[model samples]
Target: MDVSYLLILLLVGAFATYFSGDKLASKVALVFALASLGMSVYILNLFNAGQNIDFLSAWITQPKVAFALKGDGLSLAMVLLTSALIPIIIYSSFGNEYKNAKSFYALILFMAFAMTGTFLAADGLLYYIFWELALIPIYFITLIWGNGDAEDRKKAVVKFFIYTFAGSLFMLVAFIYMYQRSKSFLIEDLYAMRLTVKEQTWIFGAFFLAYAIKIPLIPFHTWQAKVYQKAPAVGTMLLSGIMLKMGLYSVIRWQLPIGRFAAIEHKNIFIGLGIAGVIYGSIVALRQNDLKKLLAYSSLAHVGLIAAGAYTLTLDGLRGAVLQMIAHGFVVVGLFLIADIIYRRYQTRTIGEMGGIRQQAPKFTSLFMILVLASVALPSTFNFVGEFTVLFSLSQINMGYAILGGTTIILGAYYMLKMFQQVMLGETNKKAFADVTFNEGFSLVAIVAVLFFFGLYPKPIVDLITPSIEHILTFINRTN
Candidate 1:
């Protein structure tokens, strides 16, 4: 049982898509994504059977690293989320033909390859390689296929590339320092080493800089909205749907277990930052006239709560954080895809210019409303499960932290429902609007179905990740 099949399936899909010719590239990519999804299902089943699907081989001997890839409950859950979303992402792109279509679809598959690798890599150096690998395709995806003013888009892409790349370099330096001390890049080796509080503090900062920029917490989130607005819808889905979780996943798998002392020491500081982001992002979202920009801020607010939950370092917090990561991944992709729909039909993302869409397209309106509700964490949606667990975890820390963090629900409902009203309600626009094409409708339906299904029965995911959370918490609770 090998977990690398997921990666191989995607990498092969990328190359296959490239040579499949433009006419067939998207279909080929979709098939590849579906294949990856099937492989993920098989891996999940094996996981349930108490099997370990791992692969290891020599990579770079000097670094004492191997091409080690393994799946525990945690990594596979992230992998499954990434796998499930890629097909929907590819399917969503069916309405329009991209220039250099083969290359475009190929890059999408390639990004999946890099991202799946990031989730499963078991060695620090291996993870770093995958981490850097994930950055390249997105730079090209945003730069080559993006929208908006060419100059502004270029600046946004470059800023993102530099900012994330710089953060990765910092993390790599920290890994190298740890490798020097432990003489191995295996995650277990890194975890086994005892560090002083000062040492843990610096390493924590290094990983924090990397993950924060990726999560784009509060002040570090300057790159997010512009990038989301400029990139094509498929690109936006990839970023919001899957790429952002890579950072959150790394925080759990890499940062906390390795730097447990610092995590305990500064838990309150990070938790406060997370709450600030929740309120700040929701308020800013309310002010955005652009639909994509509003969704961008909304994403920031939701992730802020998740990050705060992760910082709590409690079983409930970790459980909720992972659940929220999965829940947010589904809902945001739907919202952004809906924004892209408006952009395609009206040729404007300005919310003011759009109205009465609901009258014109009842089906679209209904689906959009459901996703909006899910985003605001309505009970019975998957998001509600995650949000409740996260808030409960925070309450255990302090009633104040829970109270402040809980504002995102009220604020999320405020901005999201308001945006829904402006975008979907009102009288039919003077200009004509068409209903969703089969392709678009299908993708939205599938995404919505997953949200509703998990919202009702989130027990499967919660159960699967609990043992792994407990495994990680052991180290987090240990003081040197």
Candidate 2:
């Protein structure tokens, strides 16, 4: 029942998939992904039962680091999201044939392993290691299996690698500084340790640079759309779905608690930066010609709002941010998979080339429409619950913040609905469009069911995450 078992399962799965031969790699990887999902659920149940599930052991004594994994409502919720979506992401790719399938599938599990570790690690050094580890698999996945011109893909992927990697170095520096002051790499020690205003500002700025680049807020977002367009569907799903959440989660887990002075001192500026990303991303998304690139911008807009909510530093804001992270993860995966399905049939990513699919593929249209509605935060959908709370949290801070943040809804609906209209409606095209295959439809349905189930009755999730959110808020309020 140790939390480390989850990491072990995925690591073993990656190696097994790599050696399983290309013919069996996909199926083997799927089985492993599902098993990991099952294990995470079991751990969640045990967590609720108040059983001891966290793991820690001595590692680097000089640095005071431990091979540590901790599970709380917050970390476990993110872990469950990662474990759950990975199976669907792996399944969604069954239709396409990739060269070196073993390596491709192996990297998927490897990436999942790194992401899960990132969520669960409690020691600062351990967390940073896992954070960086998550990047490697995705880097190879995009470079090897990506969709566009080889040169362009390389440039985009490399730029992403450099941006994220460089940003993380700042985080590392901050962590080292914290360790110097606190004399331990444990997150709790770092959080409890005191720092002068000067120190807090430097640490906060370093962590902000790291997370913002990964979150890719407005100015730092140049690397995002290109990378999404170039990467394969699965890579895009991992990036948009689970990878970005790492940055947001760290904002709550590491940055706010460790650097509360700076977080509080510059709250408005940080919140404004997030809202700006929302408006900027929404406007840019309006004009995107490529489907994946459009969705990428849409993700930026949504994440910007989530970031804004977290910076509000209210219990409601942090809670809503977690809720939206889970909600956005599933919805974005479904959206990109839809884009990939259309590409499979039409062999193009351009919106101008697509039309009248509503006439030919009712099932696909229905599912796509549902995903579009969810993206815009329609009532009774999961996104609504999260978005409403986030905006409300912003309102408590300032009406202007809420108003600007709320524009995501108006602008999101305009762009997403317009994308849907252009892509799914209008005159019948000469090219024949087939309905989603059982595999594709089944995946979409699974995603839709989660959104609706949680949207209508979100109490279970709200309950599970509240205590942890409160715990983090305590540290955040310490600066006051």
Candidate 3:
């Protein structure tokens, strides 16, 4: 199957849905999403069979840059994720009454196109293009349809754009530096280029800054909470569920390999910062009264642990980080969706204002409880498997770091259970609350089923990624 052909299909679908009447726009979008998923699955099979799908040509003769799109295990995983989640997000929005469904579905499809391109682009410049392209539709989606005061929503959107673009510029600089050194823009060529310790350090710093900001690590994470609070729940789901993984994925795909020596030299610093983020994010979340704000902070804490795992540069560490990335994406999306459901029912996000929800919404309560367990790393949940692997890998480097990082589990449970109890267990409020609708229940059930399925059988993913990670580690070791 031609990857470019699939891309064109998605592009056409977006425009078709855009012009289609609002009454039929959603059905059109759903069809396109399913088609994209089918294409992604086909790509995955081809990738697993070790076939390379090239979509572009050799461009520049002097700098050795070519337009290319290829799917490896990592790219395939991301494509599958994007394809799977877009439809779910669309389905989750079925109950929403939008002013212009045509435009909404179109924007969603365009975003999907850009995200798929980001994962598959084989050239640094092309990847950067897709990376920025992915953000444009989202900006509009949030600005036009987001909650809260319109002025505040605009402010949040601008802040999000500035924060992300600032990081992206630094990443572009790193790419330019590599192109200069390797005389090629192909990622494979960049991986083969060698740099002095000083050069690697500087380049690594720039790349790390970009990814860290996207992951919204501490000190750079101020934009996240406000964005989550202001954006529509669908927008939040895309940002937390699929967009953040791009940052984490880049850390593994480019930064560590390109700056191998520097990464090793500064391992302690990364570990220390990650541990601080783990504690700080959790502490801050403990203080948040809004459910969306709390989940935003919780996401920060979880990604911090993923960053720590990446720095470990061991097989176990990388594997754990990869698994954790997928696990956290699913868990966070489910949690935010639940938050949306609660808000729809109670017309508020404040935990202080919610009570006796479980008495009225048994299905919502059950699903929310399961998601909460996953978030807190309870046994039998996917999060526990990922967290345990990461903690064990951290312990291999430093016992104290492991212990400190592990404290997030206890703090996580404290906040999660407290939030759950407040919303579900207390006396009924004066206002009447509706039970979970079938649509809402189906969405939550799908997410919970995935969480349990992956938790019990993560080996397939682990196996898929092992070869690529092994290849990367080998290159690093050889260079060292």
Which one is best on lDDT? 2
50-112 per-residue lDDT for model 2 (tens digits):
999999899998978899899999999999999999999999999999999999999999999
Least lDDT summed over 10 consecutive residues: which range in candidate 3?
A: 471-480
Which RMSD values do the candidates have, in order? Answer: 0.8, 0.8, 1.5
- In candidate 2 the C-alpha lDDT for residue 326 amounts to 96
Model 3, 1-480: lDDT tens digits are: 757766787889999999998998988998999899998888777777877766778877766668788776767777777888888888888878788889988999999899888878889988898899989989999999999999999999999999899989998998888887777888888888878899989889998888888887888888899998998999999999989888888888888888989999999999888888899999999999999999999999999998888888988788788888888988998999999988887889999999997888787788999999999988888888889999999999999989998988999999999999998989997777787777777788888987898888888787777887887788666644
What would the TM-score be for candidate 3 when compared with the true structure? 0.97
| lDDT (tens digit, per residue) of candidate 1 on 1-480 | 689878888999999999999999999999999999999999899889988788888888785788999788899899999999999989998877699999999999999999999999989988998998988889988998999888999999999999999988989999999998999898888889998888889999999999999997978999999999999998999999999999999999999999999999899999999999999999999999999999999999999999999999999999999999999999999988898888889989999999999888888988999999999999999999999999999999999999999999998898888888888888667888899889899999999999999999998998889998899999989856
Clashing pairs in 1: 382-455
TM agreement with the true structure for every prediction = 0.99, 0.99, 0.97
lDDT per prediction? 0.92, 0.95, 0.87
- In model 2, residue pairs whose N, Cα or C atoms come closer than 3 Å (at least 3 residues apart or on different chains), thus clashing, are none
Predictions ranked by TM-score, top down? 2, 1, 3
Give the residue spans of candidate 2 off by over 4 A.
none
